[model samples]
Target: MVQYPFCALLMLSLLIFLATIPNAFFTQACLTTGYLRADAYQTRCPGVEAIVFAGVEQAVADDPRMAASLLRLHFHDCFVNGCDASVLLDDTLTFEGEKTAAPNLNSLRGFEVIDAIKSELEFACPETVSCADILAIAARDSVVLSGGPTWQVLMGRRDSLFANKGLANKNIPAPNSDVATLVSKFQNVGLSQKDMVALSGGHTIGKARCSTFSTRLKGSSSSDSPGLDKDFLASLQQLCSEFDNNNMTLAELDFVTPATFDNQYYTNLLSGEGLLASDQALVAEDGIATRNLVETYAEDPQAFFEDFKTSMVKMGSLKPLTGKSGQIRHNCRIMN
Candidate 1:
């Protein structure tokens, strides 16, 4: 090895110390084993995930509208890098001309929830942890706290080097994908149709902007057209005379239990209350497998949690620049 200046060597040692320290006892960057497998990380994620979820839950419980904002965090991340929280930065792409379907227009209320949780954590633990991890865990917890499902979580994920707005526009699946297309999209990210439907459970707890549902309102195409409960559709029409194609007027995926994580999302589908045309398609004639997933998850929260955990693991694995693939950033929003 080439000899270096004492100062340079000291700096290298310090960097290693910081990275490892984050994964040690000071923060939630747990170390059950090593980085070679995801199971090692799983042992550490749930507890932290619960904390984040609790903060989000409290932030939005009394006000259902806040759910939309909280839900946007997950949408922003997933669209960019399989729920990786890589689209919340100032440099990230915004929805551009011709209506780029990126993860912009996040719910402002949701940011408040994360900020509150960060404040509490800082008060309790000081600077031992990172806010980026809090964002990921909070998004996960928000779903569970909203009565979605108890996701099987893993820990030890380093924050992203950069948050890409442009990337979000390219990766997020639309609200109107057909079964085959959705399956392919999820597969590209190492998720299954089951994961797609379960992750889509986020829809149960949030509101859609009017822009997201404009096509549904006009019945643009069979897949784009929503098959909502008759009464709910009428109520939606009353809420907006014509779709503004904005976030304010979108219908939720599960209206029956929007604030709670339960089987009701599936039950809603069975009842013709599925909020989007894509959601409805999960149970359409040729979509029995997916429909059964809804039914199965509805019947067993434990099973759902298992699938959710597996799916989350798979989702995180997609296109990851791990093991020297990507550099850890001091700030999650910027590329170092």
Candidate 2:
């Protein structure tokens, strides 16, 4: 009896000791095959996250819109070619890139901001940082600056040698996508429907071009779009009519608080004020689960933030070129 109790006490003490170890160490050990580690640069390039965060901070301070642009950049890059920074490449003769894709061309911005961040990192740590990782970190910093939840963005992603313009056009979720299409697009990228709704909360801080949502305006189509608020549609019609270029005219996705990253986006959808057809579909369409998620997020800001952070991490980790599979680009716009 004495020996049995002594052995049990020893085992309990050993278990407590093991539990004290940093969870990341065991996590990295198991996930090292094709995944990244949060502290990947801690040894190789210390202060990397700080450098990227400071760069993003100054940029966002100068232009608050840059935060949304950077966040969207990471999403687009991850969706197309597995967060490989292929979206950052510039087109050249005999070389086509995602920059001109239907989902990107004239729509995506903030490349200059990324270029500036890359330059600082190269100066401080040389080629130790990959452009793909920069996009990931910059995205996290953007969310934090926009008053959203922040998660540890896993690093160690490498830039792809080739761009996927075709995938970029086909893979990205469209503004007019219904709840079903949105669910399908996200699922294609290894994310669940819960992630789709949470990630859509990103629209809280971005603006949509008139061309992206103009068709939903009242009388602009044969039937007034279902679930679209009448007053919101009239206002959008007036705002869009003022511009000679549909692409030039922009509308805030979250009508109440456009620049902040918060649950107001879900609230907007609940009130039939979502600027995009896809956004409203979350609440109005036949997606009962998505509608429940929208209601939950609208009722709880913390839940929305938590889900958004989780989804962002999962999205950033999708199909990344880890280990020796890809090369780190000296210039984000071109291969080293």
* Estimated TM-score for each candidate: 0.69, 0.89
Candidate 2 structure quality by residue, lDDT tens digits, 1-336: 445688899999999999998855665453345658887877568889999999999999999999999999999999986899999999866569999999999999999999999999999999789999999999999999998888998888888988988899899999999998999999998999999999999999988899897668647532478887777788888898887884579888887988899999999888878888999999865989999999999999999999999999999989999767778899999887
List clashing residue pairs in candidate 2.
Answer: none
Residues 1-336 of candidate 1 have per-residue lDDT tens digits of 899999999999998887875333433222322242323333333244445666777776667666556555654565565443455444435332211334354433455566676566555554323344565566566665555554444444444555554555555666677788778877776777788987765555666665555556554233344455666666666666654444465556566766666666667777666766667778777788998898887787667667765665556445433333344343434444
Please name the candidate that would achieve the greatest lDDT relative to the true structure.
2
* lDDT (Cα, 0-100) at 56 in candidate 2: 97
What shift in Å separates residue 142 of candidate 2 from its native position after superposition?
Answer: 0.5
Model 2: residues >4 Å from true position, as ranges? Answer: 1-33, 218-223
